[model samples]
Target chain A: MDTLRLASHGLSKHDQEILSKQLKMLRGRTACEWVLVDDYRSADVTLVQGQPPSDMPGIIALASTKAGKSGRYHLIEWPIRLFGLIDLLMAIELEWPARAATPLPTLSLAHRLARIRQDQWLDVAGMVAQAFQAKDEFRTTVSSFDELIERLASIDGASVRFVEGHHPLADQEAALEPYSLKAVIWSLALREEAIKSRQWHISQQQFGIATWPLFGTWETAPWMLRLAALYGRQPATLADGVELTGLRVELVAAFLHACELCELGLTVKQSTRPPRIESKLPAPESLLARLRRKLGLGYKRT
Target chain B: MISKILFIGPMGAGKTTAITAVSDSEPITTEADNLDRAQSDKATTTVALDYGEIYLDEDSSVLLYGMPGQDRFDFMWPILAEGALGAVLLLDHSHPDAVAQLDHFLEAFAALVSCGALVVGVGRVQNSQDIGVYQAHLKAKGLALPVYATDVRHKQNVLLLIETLIANAELNEILER
Candidate 1:
């Protein structure tokens, strides 16, 4: 960032001379040394005219008629502006390992688990961390799963998101409890204690889970497995699931929220199929049941 | 009448022990002196398959087949798993490439995976968090299969894996209906 070295290729000698003179005019204006180097190989920035070199070098300022940012290179255009070149060089300064300013806009995390990337860190204790002065242990009737999204939503939430590398909470990483966005969403969705969420609920539309929710990962009721199996098989509504599992409709609704929140992709059913259709085929003896009975195996919630 | 269930995993992941745990009789194994000692330090390894059985009734029986633990025997996986009720994939968590072994087995037994009839049991794991890693791996591969941390020597632990398989099978049956 100290020396703004510039090198040109395929450009007229007249343009190179003019560019050097223009850089010298802004000597005191910029803190760095704006030197127009003769060597294209060693230059910090390269200005190319017509065709750029095959070998991809450092920051490229393509002198083209095209406006705005191209794929990788910056457009210097027919007549390069000194400020544009300076701004491009300053951007290079911002990219150095020591500097810290790739600001991410803070947004409230509610039922928005899909938006959270795998790399982003979440501080479960948003505003509550300061108000209650609790470290990270918070619980509810639903899930003792850090009380992240639900608690955040209930308290009108304090925004939380740390970038993968440009971490805002890089210093306090170990101090804060970093929960996987999916795991947090799954726990919040599986509010096992209450049949229904206090604040909001997923829509009443009939849907089927695209995949099962790795139920064994959490210490939850065995009923969760039954619920997961049912919905995961085919599209069904809360009402459809109610009679099947003999669980409350609200509880099933809560499960739906868990599915949707975790970005499990619950495929909404089409009109061609009835919501609850009875199989016309005769029921056969379930081999699985016979095998279970043969092995004297009964599922106990482990 | 004979029905089939499978025990599958990488070499030395306790597929034989898991079968013997839940089997009515001692499982018959096709083993030889271990040549791949680098993979696992064991006197013998099942090169072909392991066989055991449980009587469903006085007349009928349930056959338990443990697929060979080597990748070379993957050809027999589809052949044996063709009509399998479901499968229990046992993994040795102590193995550095255990997760990779999981991906390998799950891919080899892609039929059971797609039908949601596969249960994963990771041996030598500590807690739910360790199980979470396996679950997360499955999650990444677009699978929601049941995963447990259990000692295969324990019959109850082995049964639990089978029970989940049965449950998944029954659930698939219900959905088909």
Candidate 2:
């Protein structure tokens, strides 16, 4: 394996020791070897805790404040996670030139962060794939919408929640005992749409009146097609539609409006049935909420 | 006041989809089976007009009118254009004669185009060259209307075209006053 010579500047002794241990641990998992060097000029990467060495070629700053500054360096926030550091190093190695005289990697720190994120996403995707493949009760793929719905129905208590943490099939979860299987399938469909838009908060509510007749010539999520098939049998209110379809209220409203435009969705009177009692269990917190708690994304919820 | 916004485009340019995507209510469309397969492969074509309404606020709403694309029905172009806030001219970049189509529509809607009440939305463009061609064409005509790379099927993009048109119209109205 090729080795990378690393040097440090401005970092505390404690941070240098931590970096050394992390380099050793990461070496076992990744192909590149990292070695600490005495001379800054000979080092392939220079980890800096404060001001970056101006003359250095390969500088990796460990401060968030240094982010976006023009320099030949990468920035990982002060408190670095092991995985994030390893990923950043690998990114640099991939981008490094063979000759020392060559210019350093042109990939920006932001681009490296995006690459690391994509790598983590792939890891999670592999785990999800393996989990689904291991399950004998659920088929990994379904050929037809009917087959998909029938298979989903076979799984008792099958509940599929969107990335937003809203369970579109929450109402059906109790009725269907094995909802996790359905959740897996729904997640795959939601993932497909999320990939297309790269925006996760787009719900049926935001989509407004465009979410109906789920199955059409237009490119749409497969889960939506299944939801439309089910809704074709019976019409429900905006709130219940959200619960049953796992789409945001706005998106569902849009679908219903599209159906109305196409004369597809049937008009029905408001249900006289009393509102279903919400579960006493606190709603599952969203990833956004967890991220907000951790990073304080510069805004507060009203 | 309710402002009317006309959506004009050639056959299969997604005019109906754009209106339906952003319309606050169910859009009323006068569509018939397309017998002219040579012109477009779409199953249906707008014969007379397509109508939808979108409220910007409680006090004001925009009425969306989509004119029939075929030149044979050019008679309705000005009729629908009457008393309108602006026009959103959608072009299919994938079409072989898209630039020519732009010129034709620009001539048809010259009144609106001259008055700063028109915004162009070019859909399905694969590269900047297509946009450059549109820009050059508009430049040659001494028009400075906003041109957008859009997917009319997407609500936000369609809304952007409408919003730009409205903003331009308002600006022109203020200048005139």
Candidate 3:
């Protein structure tokens, strides 16, 4: 009969492991019970041991009060804390716009949250990769997450609504209202900082695996949110300058391809040549006489 | 309005001569003038790119950009190929690597295919037998793209190649619908 106060931010991997060990050792005693809650203020769990002094028959004698002074109690003989952590993650994900509307209380919340975070990270990296590959579009690629977020907010049909009440995020949301038009600007700036510190190529690979066949796999509802996360990475060039040697052909080809994709026109400058002069002789006499006289003169084909 | 046309081909494919024959103005030589110009330290083969122009109309000019024959200069290809309305891929009948080079370029620029860019094969075939081989090789790759056999030096033959490009573009525009 020990009580522990846990924060809502919830378990790390080590914390889940510790709870599993505690659950198995305290089983088969009406003494064995646990509590679950959305927050500390909401619930508590209570387990009273040595009620009837027996493992099975005596275990049935203890009275359990989950609602009063129990601190959100629960009972388990297996490692279920991991599952709880997963549920927490799922809740966060579901609450966030990126995940679907349904809140995830059944699935392991931690796993889902980790997966979602990883996916967004990779997405940012992948967009950067695409920017470099499609150099023609690099000029317009959004590098910072803040910029990306702002861009999303400015998206043609985007709309934002405020839900009032004593909500956890209410203050944060209210504070952000003045900068709504500047939207995600701070987030984008933070994302840019994150990208500068990351290994972009490796990040790109991770991103590719995270979001395979990105063209059509994404849902329309989460499209803006996902894009906002992806644009988190700031713009960075993979190849600063290619060697002028052996890569000339490839470089030239790439340059030309970029120009073509960007619709750039070539500037052609034509050179003018000097005019030529013809040496002249005496004039012809008459129609017949002129021909005869011109023919008679020592004239060579010019 | 200037319409750029790129001439792409394998080594010794008469790309240079073709430009000389069709150009309205004196061709600006980009081919290497000195041995040192080539990084290879060999005097044998080195050239940057070839440039020429053909007038489509009094207002519209079609610039002919000739890519160097060697695979070594393939770097400059995309730069030269930019904004090209169509490409004339010249293949030397005698060259053993002609088919491979053709495959390389087509695969490399797959995006261009979707953009309605015309790729016309200009083969130097001495007889009908050679033409059959060229057509067969192209068909084997599932490329039913337009292919022509003509002497690059002949003015009328080059004109035919240009017409083939225009026709191919029109056909694609219709097919897209």
Candidate 4:
């Protein structure tokens, strides 16, 4: 087995040696090589960084992955480290076939869309489709209303609309129009089976939003006009589809919201509940702790 | 605020361990080792919910509840999970039939998932081979939930597990706005 190390701004000679020594046991004592992908281009290095890089800000380094044959790369940052280990074990089990590529491009594209767009109420379906077309890691799925609003806010020129009096979100929700044409497009792109059956069609078209826009705007659009745009709309079904990479459904929504905020000049107000603490019963000693006591064995509480 | 929770899994999947891990006091468990009708393998299984509590911040308390892992006790799930804010689905990766165990619990309880519940999967598979196999199996179930290889032997590990689930749950709630 081979190992690699990646650093923030490329790896130093010292960092390379450190990773090699740390992973010396990766391949038993058999023949192994340590390659340093200084530019962070190698797919074989485990890219670990404390916090995120200053340039990348909120974006964390994608997990390490092996080099693959097919262009069908599937790099991922599994929420659990065990999964990453699983990837390695699976590779070994499969005799080290083409590596699973990380979906870094898609993630980068998502972040770029999020940080660079400005739109007022962008179309969810269109944005998701575009994301998939670009081979990003965000798949179109049933999303929370708040996610849509936040993503829109992240993009430029995009804004969410709330039902004039019925909106429940604070500043973000109060500003959105109840009926949106874009929501219909979104519903069509996702949940194809449901759309084909015409199950979520009405709700899809009649969807209302309340959230901040990607950009701010004071102009109020007429409800009747917005409703007209929503009228005569049929359920959205999956016509053509593209697969996303290894990101969570919620993450996709957040990335999309970020993109919308950047692309559209939409702004919104939101109402949120203060974090409430839930009360409960008392705690119990762990079975392990109990067993140690019963056995009269000293166990230090670390 | 009582943060309601539910535990769902097959018999002997460690739901009690999870509840007991974070509970502030001794967990109230209904162990059914004496019931003649109980499955021989599940003789010492938890029959009803395991109730306990833990505090995070001054204003919030996380109420812990565990559900019976047996189908015979399925009738009590609704009552046990009446106001549950989320759920923890235990996966006995060490079991000979891991997939079968998951199907027994999750396949039939789609309602729990639909109610905006945050279900975290705890897989106890130790062997690397078993871990990979179980990972693929979990993916096949479309659980889409985060899974971790956990051991309840350490309090710190247990705390980290709970925190991870809580963070994810909070992230969903925040995004749901």
Candidate 5:
């Protein structure tokens, strides 16, 4: 069992004594044992009766009468009770992502890249081999970018994640057959199915083109241009884009999610609920539809 | 409405070929003997403008224009770019001053660039991926235009560049309003 030591600040002389006694009583019963300590620097959690020190690092429990306005610190109503303390500790353990006690032998592609850049871990062969075998969004090996794009076009994009830092599926030899982050994500979005995001909740957030998608060597269509045009006006939800463009909701969702993932810093997150999806677009004098017919954009002419 | 798109870059950046690749018919070009071997070894280069047209209908067409590679004929740029959709700036990666040329052509076409109507296409040099290098340069200059590694001779890449320019043109319409 892990031992979690806690330190207290602004505790009454009698309250500290009671906490010490409570710690002794609750030591062996819980999954994680708790002990009261003097120094916060040496403790897992620190309970402060008043305002917790600003920008404090470790887990902090604010024992205050008022509810927490900033959801940074754990809240414990004063005077703190045994149940509050127990609940706070339990919640902290639950909230933090559970990393196994032992690290995995085969590190992820992201981890390997990080290790190579940070620690200069010289495992290029291993990195290449691991990435080639990657069944997820981390799949890196391709003869040409066009080939990879063709593959992405045929596969299911719903499971692919537009994770930051892992945007470019780069190896040492990626320079020869390189792909832009935009191209990779855009091709994945071609699957035109409901997709996952490493960052945003696709249904819950509004998306806009904060910046243009940096598609290199990847052919774009008129509807995509229209999509960019719509986003250029204002930030909109995926459903809004779908209705206006008459594009697949899944396609728009994945595309918007990819744009956001590229760190274009779109205007999103004002609302948590999904938008009202309506079937409406600009008046029949649509230049995009006309352009499509004249230029053979929607259909492959060549 | 006629939407004219220009392809501008330094000598031998494959502007003529790019225009030819996507043009519906054989493009018109005024090619003269290359007196500047130090710049480009190509036997002939565009002196005035290389013209190609995709006939949209009997009334209108999408005009593909290629600006003269040499800066001496730069007087024709603003004249050609007037009421133009945008321009694609192709770079010959082998040129020693390719990066400098990027800055130069970008500065030359600042109006088109500022309105998000420019896409930079850099041809690859051997096994090198210089897309990031060009992109980093664009980023440093606070330009958000797309930089692509392409062989403009390939119809796919040329078509994509045209698509990108169209996308930019559509985007500019919204942003301007």
Candidate 6:
């Protein structure tokens, strides 16, 4: 069977190895067999760590920011997972036949947005609103609370209100008031009482998902980011999260607490029992034995 | 008396390097060509364990054992950890899942960790924030283990981890008595 050729750009040796291994695992599962090629020109797809070359064909951009998107140029966020990458490649392959002609625009919106100074909020908001309206998916990519509110306000016939003490425009329409994304995230975490009283309410799901703005953002702490990513994929208890994400039970509980405050986490029944740690005894002549002998103790292997 | 100290972490966290750095004599390493290159970029990895030793005085010495960092060899962890005086949990701050790796090793060596016999040495930290993340993680667990930004390639840093683990073991003994 003919295989799909893939070439990598700017990825570390480790990342390339991971991609290769994941691709090999994906061979029998999917009809498309992905093979890594050193030559970019002959490859069917080019996976890049940062920006892809202008001349590159069938680009798969790996980055944290939502800078480039097209029918052909797909973006997978950094800290790439094996499953996520495979899903993206399969999507691109499926869409290739239909999107072959238009090929997505190469403009780096993330790069352009990053250059906007703090003082350029209004101007940047206008540009962001335009981009968001032009591409519905852009609504999910808003970086800040201000940008999110701005994008929401630009939508015709949308009603947005901030609850009591949550925003400066408490109990007032969001169209009339300005709020930062940081304040919103902070209020959601710290001011649970206010949030429970309906601190903020939007009439419509502007970004498809109810909490799309909160999915991947700088405001999310590292542990929270890991937890959110894992839970966002599926419903899991705190213990499940600890086991899955390799975070401590206490740390996972803290994240769960924050998610509960924000009403972001789903309530699932958790196992009451602590995770069991299996113990295996080392060989008698191993280092453990040597240490026990030196300490004037007999080996008591467990 | 010889006290055993175990070094544990994920792949590429520098267990072998840390052991080699402080060993008084040549370190004994059991390395093989890494078949799971996807887990690490290194051409070779410790399949069994890396062993080294250092003398504290004429009568007492410390045996350092570095466990294979991959999950597949996790069965060797409890074995190596048996009769251990304490542990040095090395972390590669540059790894994509550094925080998760920290939690995994901590859970794997919970016996040593709960007794305050674990010292975390985080290597390749980009900034102080990386150290802070680890510190916060331990703090959240109610653990007061000493955490230091270290480079296992350097003898001084490796010694710091060893000394910290030894100190914790001594302190635990005193408190228990």
Top candidate, metric TM-score: 5
Model 3 chain A: ten consecutive residues of lowest lDDT: A208-217
What's the CA error at residue A1 for candidate 1, in Å?
50
- Worst lDDT 10-window in candidate 5 chain A: A114-123
lDDT of 5 by residue, B54-145 (tens): 77666667788999989789888888988887899999887889999999988888888777778888886442235656766775665556
Compared with the true structure, what per-residue lDDT tens digits does model 2 show for residues B107-156? 99988877767778888976434465786677566565556678887876
Question: What DockQ values do the models have?
Answer: 0.30, 0.05, 0.02, 0.02, 0.17, 0.03
Clashing residue pairs in candidate 1, if any? none
True contacts kept of 2: 0.00
Q: For candidate 3, give the docking quality class from DockQ.
A: incorrect
lDDT for each residue of candidate 1 in A1-302, tens digit (9 for 90 to 100)? 35657788887988888777667655654445668888788887788887877884777778776334577777754666443454454455455343343332222253433333234444444431211101212222233345444565553223453334444535643454434345555665565432333222233446677556645444345456666766765567665666555566677777766766554555543233344733221123445556756677543322
User: Candidate 5, which segments miss by more than 4 Å at Cα?
Assistant: A1-98, A101-129, A132-240, A260-291, A299-302, B125-128, B172-177
Q: Give the CA lDDT, 0 to 100, for residue B101 in model 5.
A: 97
Q: Grade the docking of candidate 2.
A: incorrect
TM-score of each: 0.56, 0.38, 0.34, 0.37, 0.60, 0.38
Q: Rank the candidates by DockQ, best first.
A: 1, 5, 2, 6, 3, 4
Report lDDT per candidate. Answer: 0.64, 0.55, 0.38, 0.39, 0.62, 0.55
TM-score of 5: 0.60
**Two-chain DockQ for model 5:** 0.17
Runs of candidate 3 with Cα error greater than 4 angstroms are: A1-302, B33-46, B56-59, B113-124, B174-177
Off by over 4 Å in 4: A1-302, B34-43, B56-60, B112-124
What value does the lDDT take at residue A198 in candidate 2? 19
Error of 3 at B163 (Å): 0.6
